[model samples]
Target: MVERQEQAASDAVMTRIGQSVMLHHAGDREEARGRLLDLWTEIGEDGDPLHRCTLAHYMADTQDDPADELAWDLRALSAAEELTADRPAGHEDASAARALYPSLHLNLAADYAKLGRREAARTHLRRARTAAAALDTDTYGAGIRTAIRRLETRLGENDPDDPRSGPPRQRS
Candidate 1:
């Protein structure tokens, strides 16, 4: 019964997060950010790790600044790590948090790239690729793989060690 109640609460939080995501998708970025901030305040720093991870992940997307986005993405990754560490091996929550690692790393990689931190971006990209091995061959998984490849190509083209690599180009 306690577990069930906790699950219900989790579901409620996810639902709210989903609503804010919808707002973001509709281009009401400021409103979405506000809503997510309110949720974060309600959840607090020591809230359920899963809730914190999910909220922070979405929060990163709504940030206008690259530094803020990186901070939120890092928060999401930290929460995911906490969730996996707190749960026993093979437990559902642990497994779920493990599944989040690829995307979290991928987002962090992109954030790093945007900040011109090529070394940090490469590190996270490698982590994302390794973590992606656990993903299923669905559209979501395929999309992530594609994004990873694209980022890899871009990074390769901008190799800092090569004098002919040229200046950094803005991503469309």
Candidate 2:
């Protein structure tokens, strides 16, 4: 069992990390990205792959350079795959990973489309739709649904094609 002293130290470390994350989120993209990279390195491969995956997604979205975006995607996808493999079956992390897989696939498909890999893009898009449909209130559920709807709409397939694709949500 971990000693109380050690546990407390770990808690302190996490608290500091959490504070840093909050600061970043509070109107500081440059600071946030810098801090995120530092935290990403500090946490290493052991902390949270999904966290890294999310960070990578943000990085990819913000990177103006195509090559850098691709690099971020590869890094995020690698982390997600590795973490998912290490997690036990039916574990919450694994379940979350399953739910998030569609977004990764969708992003990959977009990249493939940009690269003119039509076949690969189509294959991944199909996987993304399937995974998104299987999701149930995952953190990425709404995003997945939105993305899937957008993709379908692009192919001339959103059922209503209304301003709001799905039912309304409580305004945050």
TM-score of 1: 0.88
Candidate 2 local lDDT, 1-172, one digit each (tens) = 5699866755665565565557656866566567657766876766667666666765565555666666777777787787789898687756766766788778866776666666666676777777777877765688787776776555333334345555443434
State model 1's lDDT.
0.90
Question: How well is each residue in 7-106 modelled by candidate 1, as lDDT tens digits?
Answer: 9999999999999999999999999999999999999999989899999999999999999999999999999999998889798878888988989999
- Given candidate 1, what's the lDDT at residue 35? 99
Q: Could you tell me which 10 consecutive residues in candidate 2 have the lowest summed lDDT?
A: 153-162
Q: After superposition, how far is residue 172 of candidate 1 from its true place, in Å?
A: 28
Backbone N/Cα/C clashes per model: 0, 0
Clashing pairs in 2: none
Q: What stretches of model 1 exceed 4 Å from their correct place?
A: 157-172
